[model samples]
Target: MRPLSRRELGPLTGAAVLALAGCGASEAVPPQSTASAGEGGTTYPLVLRNGDREVRFERAPQRVVSLDQGSTEILLSLGLADRIVGTASWTDPVLDSLAAANEGVPRLADNAPTYEVLLGADPDLVTASFGRHFAEQGGVVTRDRLAETGIASYLSPTDLDDGQSVNGGKKARTTPLTVDSLFQEVRELAQVFDVAQRGEDLVADLQRRAREATEGVDVGGRTVAFWFANLDTPFVAGGKGAASLLATSTGLRNVFADQAEDWPSVSWESVVAADPDVLVLGDLRRDRFPGDRLAAKEEFLRTDPVASVLSAARAQRYVALHGAELNPSIRYVDGLAKLGAWWREHGQDL
Candidate 1:
């Protein structure tokens, strides 16, 4: 089957010219409960913390701006689509289940929208999956700046680490990410919206799906390499990121497991040396770089003199996955299911 390109997928927005970046997960810090005694539901002036950063909600946010697709989908899943005034920074199309709900939400930009554009929406709250989106160096606006404007901001707990900058900076994972990290985000967001029950339900559903996907499935530690994008020096998955969670869940070993960065660029020569058993290619629908398209990545592996000789390439062992699935989001379980299914179909033969 031919892989879809960014152009074929249609533009996310007229201004989406840059590629989406990857994020790292941090340890989950339990959100503090400020409810009064005998309170039946979440109370106002709710305090949520991610690492050292915290946002207190006096009331449920009515107008929200989700700065990235991952955060947007989480809100949509929680049945808060009506509250989202605008969204931006997409890597792939919204999940099929969310298409109807997402249809009316305005896409502010393909990548991060300008600070002025984001503020133009008059949002009561803003959320993002990556700290980079709120960082001074790479983000459109700093979280502190948002606070000054009386706008509350929530950065995914998955992106926070203790004593680290809420703005994008080097975050060393004390422990690798797990499904629990994703669950923490859902629960916290649900709490913020005064929808704790919905968050619990969503987490339960994801857990059920994950168990069903890997039930009685084991591949005896087969090695795989996850290639996200960039052809010249491909950004491969590292040990402590979402890819590792997917690999561990499916009983597959990541070839680049030694590297700690979420997505580290490595030489083609190094990839050749690792010679992974399966090449998990990210079928990104973004046109930021040369090999972001699945077809382009596949073609490169087949034609490049150096890459063609790799065992996985020669054997045509490939798994095409959406770029969003490779990141730390609800789609991560989708990636796990795909990998498990692939192994079920081909593991015996290999």
Candidate 2:
């Protein structure tokens, strides 16, 4: 099977859970920094961070190549779609406005593109979120190898070690993943594109809106729990991950906020014990989601005798939203805005 894109992994894939564990607490700054001063006039050096590897770009990358969805999405949000010469894999369909811009951006190879194809793209920079994408065992395009080919790369901080890994294995590490960290990444990428000023403006706007939305909206002391797809297995979003950010941003109290880290698999019995006020069901059904999916999900929640007793159920307050869209990115602001609107329209003064 092909290595799954983050969204394709879904709630059952356990990839999000693993990714969450890999994520470290937000850092005050990028791991490395540099300014490119030259005729290129871009003055942006690629800054790479995700543990052991670090890099800097000297100019705005003209012929850019992104190897992962998150990095590609970030580039699109920065309005650098024209600069992106190639992509490896894509999850969501490109919006119509940007589809023409992405034309001829080759897929490199099926899953992991080869070095010759990457070099063929003649890109100045190659970016990704996972270290494994850049380097795996067996002749994979290592960062050093790519640099040797005159291309620089980066990995997101979410994949860094930062003392979050346990003896090179998985363990219970509860570091917080903050929106601030994602903002910093955006800033770094903006700098790469020589658009830091624009990035700062966008962040300010998003922060202001998020702050405004959260103002004075009490949840009436009701707590919330996030449900991804499978209710029987009870895949839940934990306190310090993307889901927590959404809940906290929208002024809803996440009942699983106490469960530190990202996606956590819990039992139906656990939901009964917590008896949260509302259930945030992340809509993963791209093809199957309907207007009534929320209602159906709520009905499914009722099957859990433990969850059935919650105040949210009695009032039928279950909410369905696209799951993949909730991750930290430019679109996060859109999600927050929608959530705030929902809370105000249906949840206020409860």
Clashes of each: 0, 7
Which TM-score value belongs to model 1?
A: 0.87
RMSD each, Å: 10.2, 10.0
Poorest lDDT segment (10 consecutive residues) of candidate 2: 13-22
Off by over 4 Å in 2: 1-50, 87-124, 130-150, 158-173, 285-314, 348-350
Cα lDDT tens digits, model 1, 20-88, are 122333222235433332222677556666554556665677889999899999999999989999999
lDDT of candidate model 2 versus the reference: 0.60
Off by over 4 Å in 1: 1-40, 163-167
Query: Where's the lowest-lDDT run of ten residues in candidate 1?
Result: 13-22
lDDT of each: 0.81, 0.60
Q: What lDDT would candidate 1 get against the real structure?
A: 0.81
Candidate 2 on 1-350: residue-level lDDT in tens? 66743223333321121111123442233334343444323453334453454554444667777876656767776778788877864434554555766665566743457777767776767776545565445334766665444455666555444623211223233566677766776777777677777677767876887777667655554678877655566667777767777776666777777775466778877776787767777654332323224445677756756667777777877665555445545556656766666677887546
Top lDDT model: 1
